[model samples]
Target: MGFNRPSRIQENALPMMLAEPPQNLIAQSQSGTGKTAAFALAMLSRVDTAQKVTQCLCISPTFELAVQTGKVIEQMGKYYPEVKLAYAIRGNRVERGTKIQDHIVIGTPGTVLDWCSKLRFIDPKKIKILVLDEADVMIATQGHQDQSIRIQRMLPTDCQMLLFSATFEESVWKFSERVIPDPNIIKLKREEETLDTIKQYYMVCKRNQDKFTAICNVYGAITIAQAMIFCHTRKTAAWLASQLCREGHQVALLSGEMTVEQRADVIQRFRDGKEKVLVTTNVCARGIDVEQVSIVINFDLPVDKDGKTDNETYLHRIGRTGRFGKKGLAVNMVDSQYSMEVLREIEEHFNKKILKLNPNDPDDLIKLEDIHN
Candidate 1:
């Protein structure tokens, strides 16, 4: 809502998306580029608030993403008092055979599928707009892909479909073709995948304890409004959160093991600036936009199951900061040989250098802190 200018993707994609004859769109852009706002405006513009019969639907891969998207729409449509929104995610209950009368509905694929197929809460025939956030994840996951396709099949032929994400693979394209027909496409070059506003750096630590010490040094020296630390595993996240907590830092932890409501609550607290540091696994990697997050710490470099460098995850992790034209910082801690290789590959893939930082030096930490400001 503080957007002073339209981002590149928004400038090019909005006209087509908000046309009189609704159009389908498939857009690819880096995080912090106003992709969600673009789609949210389109969804709001298309909804017939006068009728209030679930005229528009937005689907995301996770509860957090769906909730985030719902918040955007809510903020954008705040003046439109007649517009009502409903979340189809878990814990949002509706009785059997209950009809949904909200103007906009948002939720995860499985829950949205249940509301459409089993619950019959919203009539697909009445929906005029459909949006899928984080489409690459939506299609690559088997269960999500199946449920998304099933939900698409139930929609009317004229329903305007929109898909937004940071990456689009060959498989995702194939899946997009199936869900959307003749969509206007918007894509960025490979080199543009990483954000330029976020100053990047790396500090090599000989041991895990050294990494923790480095983190303490940085936090002790800098006045970070909010920082997100990403770990390779849930165990690492829990340990780091506990360690930070013991050090008297207001810390919050999030991972796959936590329930949907618990995860949402943790994120809410972080957004409200109740936590100074948030330690997490990959759950908050994509589409979690917290504007106050000025620093993103890669406590452990991201790698896939086969130990391959996940460039997309790295981009998303850093993208959490540097949001909406704000200067931010991303610091990577290389504690092992494998992590060193992972960082090197990520550097080469993005063609960006990660400057060396001396964690023990006060001057070096102060410089790192200034990069974000």
Candidate 2:
């Protein structure tokens, strides 16, 4: 609501979403581009204050994202106090057996499906609009396709649908076609995908064990205000966080295995500047925004189950920083020949060369400061 102007995605997609005889929408843009506000405003506009039943349903991939989206909806709808809001995320305050009387419901797909099918807490027939925030991640990482489809089936056939994400794979696009019919699509070209505000770099390590040493050296040489180190697995994230903590670095570990409360607390601590670094897996790669994070470290480059390069994951990981057109840096640690090849693939995909970092030369580390300035 405080925004003075619309972003490119908003400028293009918002008008179509609010147009007469509402049509489905599929939008792809970089992160921190006000995609949330765009969809939130569309949902708010469609809601009728006189009706108390759940008219708009917004589903996110994670509990943290659902909570965050709920806050955004609340803030944007501050002028409309009569529009009740409810969240169906884990640890939510909505009491059991209490009919969700709210006019709008924001939640994870699984929880929203459970409440609709099993608990009967939400009346799907009353929902007039459906929005999927971070749709690619919801369908790809969380395996929410089946649940989301089931929930959609419960809603009225005429309900409006909207899907938004920063990156969408070919497989996800096929799924979107079946979920959203005759959609108005807004997508960015490959060249426009990666954020220009980020200064990307890579550090070469002789072996996998040398990556830890290189990470420490980079941390020691650079003056990082706040940063996020991404790993390939929860085990690696935990190990790296412990190693960094022992080295007198303020660090926090977050992964999907932890309880929702623990994850929320870790994110809060990182956002509040209580933690200097957050070590996490792909769980935080999407829908989590921390403006103070000026740097992103790929302790382990992302790869698929078959060990192929995952370009979408790579973009979202770096998108954690360089938020909202702000200057940022991303450092990739390449230890093996395979990892180097993967890094090469990422560079080629984005059509940008990642600068090399030399730990032996403090001058290389100073380049980060220069880029930020």
Candidate 3:
């Protein structure tokens, strides 16, 4: 009901689930394509006002996503006044101690598991629908497998399950097969080779330190409203954010080290236009959407197991900008610290030329208007 126009996933899977015999559903779609609404609508349709002891449980990978999903539910459920909804976070209260039987419960895995064990908040046996958002990331993030399996065990034998992810690895698919009953599978056509919306560029530097000078020059020349700088680790993110702040840039750092509240607040400030730049690791790379990000700077390349730029991670990093058919820019800083082969992989996989920076000529730093312009 929200978009009026169904997403690719909803166009193919929603009708089948609503019309076909009751069966578990596995829907996979890239992020920002409205996969959240697909499952949210399905959960709302099946929820009954009379019986509400947590009929539907939605698990998200990050607190930000959990909160965002909760907000979406609030807006979508305005039509259904009788439907009561609540969210459980890592440190939040579990809805009135005495189970009011919330119609829908949205939470992260750790917090949800704690409440289920400590507060006896949600009786999974009463849950009729289960939706796991960002299924692949849930598996990749550690300390969730045991809790997820335990949560599955608590659910009723016949309850319908829905698993969604942008990238479906073999291990993640295998995990779903073990839990979900023989179910219908839907994979939307992913923009596999490269992001069409982003005008990607890369610059070669003499050394790792020179990369920062290149970024600083770009920073000085461009009037970007907002940007995200991706680093390899939390330490580097903090260092870069601090360095930019020293240069009179309004920047904030987000890494796994910071508390969840801190990260959430920083993201909100960035969204509010108070922060000009956010330097962060790849941790927040997936499923975190902030509009008006004109550029994405890869200060440190995302390397795979073989020490190469991971195509999926790079794609997702650049995908942050140029979203929803908008023009976006992605700049990569490469130096001798990384093998030329890695740079070659990025260009080869993306099927585009990587630009180089000329430090002597300041004119090279000028921002090009939109590609079409």
Candidate 4:
């Protein structure tokens, strides 16, 4: 709780959330802008610690984010030692017929659903507060929307509802009406969704190896507090990590195949500064808030399953670096005609220009750093 004062989103959303006769809220704020804390405080304030029941519940799209939210709730509720919390994620198994006595629960949607209905570990009717962190991503992902709707239906009529995320598309907005109808809403304009603090650029590479060399130049030229490299596929991420390792750089690789514990450990180690470079896919893209990440490299430009340009994913990728109004950088590697088309689409979608940079020049990188400073 090193918060000197309430952030913009917190100042506006927290009052409506923590007011008398609790109200439902739908807030949209950029990453690393205290959205989790706003909802965490609201959940903790609504719980009765002496009852030892699961009064508050929070769900995230991925296991890493669930654990991340759990840690924040843990730190903020330090004074109330009696306020116990439990995780309903994979690998944290509970025997059949066991009941959870914790006052707060944080988990992924499927596990949380099973615990509340099938396993009977938590009483859905007894839950007084429900928070869906990263709701846009949660609704967009397959199967998460249905499971979340089920959980929402199980809660009592008076239960307070909260949904938070950085960006929301037209489709997801329509879907929110079914979950929390007629809730107070707050969000930014489409043009302001991508922060001005993050300087954007695109470097044309003749081949994949040139892209790797360009990354090396960026690392050797700039004074990066930390850097995250995002690849669209696991093959590219593995190859880049190995190449960086061969260059005598400490790097970490994260992909979809890694177990929950392994992924959590890798993220924690990167957060602790054990590694300066982390090469990963879109798994860590949504809401992982690491303050030291000064730059992000799109080793591959983001695209949806149908190979169309995904502007929302691109925003989340760059949003990882610039935290709480700090300056950050994003560089995209364009190697093919398809990539070029995707890049152009992204620029037009965001209504901002992505400046061009020479991929082979070391001096060009220094200029970017100078501008960054």
Candidate 5:
């Protein structure tokens, strides 16, 4: 998994990161694009086993991502048995003093900061590598900006810093540059340009009430092996999954409301192909990898307070499919004029036309390469 095969992102970004004199790395890639495994293997390969007091620290915005990344590190460390793995998430009952001083520490920024402030378990002096996973979300949500600054201040100034994000925001860039020493920017191919393998289509509906009808039509029309239905809120995600399940579509729901184990189970079911469609919020719209997902349905268009979803969000929604060079489909259900505008913006940003198809039309599957060519 390390040397034999490299994915597109890995092929482009890994060597620069793993170079002998490692320049600080700032990587921009889409979700499900194997960025985690790239950095995980890199961290494992770089950490010194004999002198260990917390050689690495990886921070994440959400507990789910932190735990998921920590799990990946634990698995990767199997090749080297000497490295120890530890986590510092809130609500976990792990012992304080001795447990957290392992070779690798992964946690949400808040918990790590709290433990350090309280003088519970961590010693930042020994850290040689610092990673900020999902750097965009951390800045977007304002979860722990001050804490991150404080943590960086505590660590040695010479420590190597690596920041990873599916989308690069200006705030992320500014903050990362402040902490990293002349970081090397590594951005993978734009989602639309490199994602020619995904078939994108949209259906226009009259109003919000017509969405249910369109949903049924899509269900009847497509053979969905594994699909993700994106919604604006957690309540909507749960409701849509319930409605689809009642309509006899094997479905599951994911949101911030779920416990860690529950989220893990839902994701496992999705990966195993036991559940055909998953209804989730924007929380699952970044840094999540579901290989069996062949389709993504936008039940409701996402928007910030200014009524914009931004190009990054659009790319992430469609990126759930067409992963690893596989052919996939993305369907957007448009109900209002604003939705149409959003679609136009996406088209212009990607420079690729999206196929407009009727739900009842039998001839809806359009090849993406044909549209681009």
Candidate 6:
């Protein structure tokens, strides 16, 4: 609410979103453009204070995002003290068998669906507004798609729907057509997709094993506030974290394999600046915003199980840094012909050139530090 001026997405969509008769919305904008604030405002405006049942439901792709969105809603609704909010995420302290009396409920799709269908914790019939934050991720991922569809089917007819994400792939767009009928669409052009605040570069390695040395060289050559190194698999992430720690670097690991509590603890420690480096897989790719992350490294470029380059994943991975117009850096480690091909595809897709860096030259690596200065 302290915003002095409206962001582009907020300026364009907020008016139509808060019109007299609510309308379905599908918006695609880059991260850190105030998309969360836009949706949070729309969700809060629809809450019925007198109703004891849940009236507004916001679902995200991950537990971290769910908790973060809930906090945003709370912070924005500071003036409305009576606007009750409930979080239905893993490890949430909400007691079992408790009927959720909150006016707004924020959670992950699977957990929210369970509370609605199995636990009967919240009455779905009374829901007035449904928001799917990071809609593209929830719709494109394998298991998450089915869960999101099932959750949507359970909601009452005529309920207002809002879907927001940084990307809306063709498949995701087709799926959204069926879910949100005659929706008002807002999207950014391809040229406008990449963040101007990020300084992107790539380091070519002679061999696969040389990547670790290249990463360490970058760290030694620059002063990184905090960095997130993205790996293609959990095994790789664990291995990298261990190797970094053994080399006397402060590092932590996060993956889907860890228990929810473990993931939460690692994220909290990193966010609090207790841990300076976090090596993770795609688990922290989307909707996990950490403002202090000035550098993002692709230890392994993101690819699907089929080994094809995942452009959306790449966008989200780099989006982790350069948050909210802050200066940041993204470094890609390309050690093989295949990785180079993938990097080329990403470059063509984003229509931006990623400069090559010679890790052996401290001058090239010092460019990362220059932006921070």
Report lDDT (CA) for all predictions. Answer: 0.87, 0.85, 0.77, 0.89, 0.77, 0.85
List, residue by residue over 1-373, the lDDT tens digit for candidate 4.
Answer: 8899998899999999999888888888876889888899998899897786899999999999999999999999999788899999999989999889999999999999999999999999999999988888898888999999999999999999998867777867876777886699988535355568889999999788999999888877788898999999999899999999999988999999999999999999999999999999999888888889999999999998999998888999998977888899999999999999999999888887899998667678878879677
lDDT of 5 by residue, 1-373 (tens): 4446877768777787688876688888766677888889778877888875778889988777887888788777777889988777876665645536478888889888766566557778778788988877777776587778788888877787888877656787787887777888888876566568887888888754466677777666656667788988887777777778788888889888788778878887777888888889887887667777877888887677688857777677778888777787888889888899998888887888887878655555323223322
Q: Score every model by TM-score.
A: 0.95, 0.93, 0.88, 0.97, 0.89, 0.92
lDDT per residue for candidate 1 within 1-373, as digits (tens), equals: 6778888989988999999788899888766778888988998888776685988889999899889888888899989878899999988978887899998999999999999888899899998999988888777566999999899999999999998777887887888888989999988645343567778999999887899999999888777889999999998899889989999999999999999999999999999989978899998898888989988999999998898999888888998888876888899999878888899999898888889899999899888767755
Candidate 4 wrong stretches, greater than 4 Å: 189-193
Worst 10 residues of 3 by lDDT: 364-373
lDDT of 2 at 174: 79
TM-score ranking from best candidate downward = 4, 1, 2, 6, 5, 3
List clashing residue pairs in candidate 2: none
Show where candidate 1 strays beyond 4 Å: 189-193
Count of backbone collisions in candidate 4:
0
RMSD of each: 1.6, 2.1, 2.9, 1.2, 3.0, 2.2
Q: Largest TM-score belongs to which candidate?
A: 4
Q: What is the lDDT of candidate 6?
A: 0.85
Question: Candidate 6 — which residues are off by over 4 angstroms?
Answer: 91-97, 189-192, 207-209
**Residue-wise C-alpha lDDT for candidate 3, range 130-227, written one tens digit per residue:** 88888877887787766777787778887888888777779888878876788789877666532666777777776656777777887777778789
Error of 6 at 82 (Å): 2.0
Q: Give residue 303's lDDT in candidate 3 (0 to 100).
A: 90
Q: Which candidate leads the pack in lDDT?
A: 4
Q: Report how far off residue 236 is in candidate 3 (Å).
A: 2.3
Clashing pairs in 5: none
Q: Candidate 1 at 239: error in angstroms?
A: 1.5
The lDDT ranking, best first, is 4, 1, 6, 2, 3, 5
